[model samples]
Target chain A: MSYAALDLVMLGAAALIALVAVVFGRARVSWAAAGLALAVLLVATGVFDNLMIAVGLFHYAPHSVLGVAVGRAPLEDFAYPLATALMLPVVWEAVGRWQPADVRTVIASSRPISWVNTAYPFAAAYLLSTTNISVTFVVGTLFFLVPYNLLMYGINDVFDYESDLRNPRKGGVEGAVLPKRLHRPVILAATLSTLPGMLYLLAVGSWLSGLLLVLCVLGVLIYSTPPLRTKERPVADSITSSLHFVGPAIVGLALGDAAWTPQLLALLAAFFLWGYASHAFGAVQDVLADRAAGISSTATVWGARVTARIAIVAYALAGVAVLLSGWPGPLAAILVIPYLLVVAPHWNVTDERSPEANRGWKWFLWLNQLTGFGVTLLLIWWALGR
Target chain B: MPGVYLALLLITLGCMVILDWRYRLFFWRGPVRAAATLILGVVFLGVWDALGIGLGIFFRGDSPLLAGLTLAPEFPVEEVFFLVLLCYLTMNLYVAATRLLSRRGGVGGDGGNPS
Candidate 1:
């Protein structure tokens, strides 16, 4: 079980694959940029000792399924960057083949890993399950982790069809652009997929899970369909969509047998705020398209400058709420400091601000999950108070 | 205070509906999408609570925060309300993030030229 034995092998293999990916992945990227991105992915996925140590969130179990130390980060940890580097390219390739002409002009402009939020958590949680896992937990986890994602993406596609068709923001993984006509099928499939995840949970005595499944369906349905399409509204869209971000985690925590204390609630709330702040800031990049499309987003309504400021405030409040949740010590609070630090400079940014001006904000948005993970570590440590 | 919370939820949902009517979320094509979103929001929390209860993470509190709902361990019904409330927020976050990364005038992506 000791990862030390497999350390050399895993590293060599990972390096080789990454190298090959770079060589043939098309969309040529610089080695250093790739390396740097790789390193960040490693860190973000818990591959970096520096982060693990700084936060006391996760310890090197010394036991890894991969049979390699892999730098003492859990073997499950590596899935993050690996998944990102791999999945993004795969999707990118698929999208390109489906629309080669547009691929070069727009989609290929950016890398999927650079744009898509890391799905590592989902990967890690799903991949690390024990055979002893109860049917209820399995069902619940599946419900939270699987079907909802399909719905979220499907609905977004339905809502954004016009924009994606009109402009086709070509850069990175430029969110999948399915045709408007296809929205119904996509939504229907997504809805159908969500049921098993929930129904399975309900069958196992987790009635609350049934409720969650119901809500998941409702949320996706509402977010994608019209008359109540929350996606088009300003504050409403952002607020409603933010649900998918925190819902699973909250449920996961409770499912883990961690009591839903005020501390836990506040922690979850802080994360929600962080997610919202990131979401709000995220809209700034699309302000032009959204405004043109007449989409009412916080960035448009509050104006980019005001929205960014609000994001900053929201982020700050989230951090403070986390800190006030009776921190185990300053160290725990300090662990999250880096996340806040990363986002601090961008607080004042506006859409009018050049890309150069807002790069930090964008980076922080992607990295915010690490902040959440960092907080989770501190909270667990505090709860254990070992 | 709890009444205020309920009022807020109603108001927020109402406002979102009205706005959707005006702006057309999903181009105002399907109310079911929004319904799906809301239902999913509740399901996420309810399932989580059940699992949390099973896992020993959450407990019921005697507080009158969310009346009529059972609190598991020390958690209040209000806490559950917040979870759904939070779903609203994070989904927005994802949309927003997607916009920035996908839209123009942003880093867009890793800038495939990676020079």
Candidate 2:
């Protein structure tokens, strides 16, 4: 599986620099700082996705080869990291350089080079292609995922208008808000982008794939705009947001023409756990804004303290699901147990309004990522037949 | 198979229209937002559809509610129908849960207080 020897070294360098950038500020350093950050970014994504694919979690046709095939991993998977590094910084820069203060500001402003915004999600999907690549996958991405994300971000901005006005830094007002008028245009863009993919699927006689695309388009529309503005409500908001995370991975079932297996089910379960944990914990940060906006998020309804607890439990569940997927050994499982028991139990009790919960959630989120990585390694090992 | 497809289409359309009507006629929120909600319903269905295909959970066997679109041996048109209908109901239930909790001013300080 040791493909792309040079690429691996570059990725290592990128990771090292990213560590420095995180410690200091990226702005304080040169473009080399951002360059280094970008380098390892896509590599990390690709390696992970590639490992997942090789382990029967999913599969992807290699667009390129780097001469390493441990079971079925290709050298091109390394490019995913490079792509991520590039796209992430692009988005970071775009949001910082071109964002407006409000929806009106966004609508009125004539920003140059705004198309760069599309790169991140595209890269996200493309990196995802390390797992599965089909016309349906692309359609699910451009039309459904990207549009839904933009709309969700816009609606979140709209709802948080007042809170955002009060706390500019935290709301992180760096992107243009999708104004009411732009709603249809965004949807139209999403819908139109899927046409080629859809047509390809139709021609291939993959009617189910085409149907998935149409349905995904419909899903994004309902979540963002109006009478259903589901995000205005609590649990629905969480579930809708979760679809964004899990929906893309749905291609797993179609990959390599395999049936849905227990391992895939475990991955989906992990997806749900992560989704719930992210929402329950993430909502903690926005309780005040969500409340002011007439939104009933879990953080608002359950209280941040309870929400935090739920997040911990959800995180724990995700960890367990990963463990049961026959990857990480009992030790890795044991490693996370203490944190789940000790740290998570007291995350938000004393100061619901304090940033302590966010800090803890961040830690736990890392644990989540670590578990994902560990599980990937384990799956690779499993594919190797122990 | 065709009958199953027709049934599923009807169920899905029915759910979409109902949810759309609720948002459009009852909520009085903007049309854009309402449309977004319906789209969301569809997105959930899509996710479920994908997962259903992937996980083999709750698939149709000898009997299906709808027919016509049997692209795969394991799936029917009604499968998509069930995905959409089930997802629509699930989303609505979540919305209701949020609403009910908000109305009670249950927890989380003034944040929980409904408008």
Candidate 3:
């Protein structure tokens, strides 16, 4: 939301457009000439942007930028001419054309219904801690809402496309199996969209929040991609998945500058446990299909019955964890009861019968809405009382 | 106040003109087309400045170098001159780049290569 951050976003966009023109267009732009043009433009920008700043034509919010200056000008101002040097020639060359993506498919790939699951935690934590809507709060909420979800699920869908193709439960709200053609765009969209908000949040938030945000993003990526695909690892998978949700809440709190009281720690512990249990429990339904598709997860390694029991135990422990959070915090312990009940039906579910756990998972999905509503009421009551 | 800012802007504008004429770049290369492009650039950037000023992201500084002249509230007359220099400089750089590149392709005629 700072001028610097905004400028950086525009600069990135301009750079991307220019790259597309050079790479994909028939313009045949000379790299040597472009580099020379860029060098000259940057030098002129250094002089004139500084001069303009000195003469009082414009100024930036000190807190928003990196505070590195050339003479008197904020470094952010150079992005203007940098962008011009990049984009003007591109406009002349090809008008920066690219293929259109299937917008609906990409949105479907993001699991739109579950957007609130991640966003709610951040908004609640930041709003509760700060007790007012700050720029960080709004930006963070918007980020966690769409781009974060897209980044998380888009990567998963792209990587999991083959496996998901074998699963009948996919191609709907659970998560559509991304086509191979859309893979590049989905990944591109996820990354390109996430960076601005991510950078903006990093700029505005405390160092603690920045650290948390980095770890959280890494968790999302590592959960699905590469040799470090934590989703293929057993207990690590559950832990990483849990962090995906709990990380946002903690980041929101840190960004809001909330005090790290014992009660807050206890509350986070319970939220972490809830996420931990939910991921393990969700994996239970996919055990049979995942094993068939040659995927390894906690449930696939542990088998369905054991994984269900483990999840139920974790849920119960989550309820116990909340009791340590003081009064209204303890009230959230009640919200875990429904999850326990939903998973109890799947306790003795076998590998062949594991697909039946999908029924419980479906119910569990709707159950989350009720749980969110209950948590919101409790937060409001707590906020009003406080 | 003296028109020191305006004078500086004019001098810089003169330098860009000199570069253009000496290299047969920009306006010297093609008068009507370069004029159209440069004018369009200034108008575009002038609108950009207006947007920034309207949004309170831009404000005129209280410098003695600036003239005691206001084209509009918080907008000084010198800004018009400044915009001209910016547009003219960009055009010159772009045209010179094209010239340097095309000349390099052909035998000899490295006349305007700034390198």
Per-prediction TM-score:
0.49, 0.44, 0.67
- Cα lDDT tens digits for candidate 3, A106-131: 88888999899899999999998889
Cα lDDT tens digits for candidate 1, A208-322: 5446545645765676578888866777776766665665554444334445568656766766676677677667666766677777777777777777676667777776766
Deviation in angstroms for A16 in model 3? 6.6
Worst 10 residues of 2 chain A by lDDT: A108-117
lDDT of each: 0.48, 0.45, 0.75
What are the per-model DockQ values? 0.02, 0.01, 0.13
Query: What is the lDDT, from 0 to 100, of the residue A130 in candidate 1?
Result: 24
TM-score of chain A of 2: 0.53
Which digits, one per residue and each the tens of the lDDT, describe model 2 over residues B36-87? Answer: 3334334433433343343332234443333435645455555455434433
| DockQ computed for model 1 against the true two-chain complex using alpha carbons | 0.02
Q: State the displacement of the C-alpha of residue B50, model 2, in Å, after optimal TM-score superposition.
A: 23
Reference contacts recovered by each candidate, as fractions? 0.00, 0.00, 0.23
Task: Estimate the TM-score for candidate 3.
Answer: 0.67
Candidate number achieving the greatest lDDT relative to the actual structure: 3
lDDT of 2 by residue, A1-386 (tens): 12243345334433443343233222122234334444434444455445444434323323323456544455544443352342223222222222234323433221212222232223343333344454344443444334444444544445444455554334222344444444333333233233333333333334554464445445545565667766556677667666655554453233223345675567567666766676667677666655665666667776777777777887688778756554433334554564476446556563337345556555654565555556456545554664
Interface RMSD of each: 11.3, 15.1, 8.4
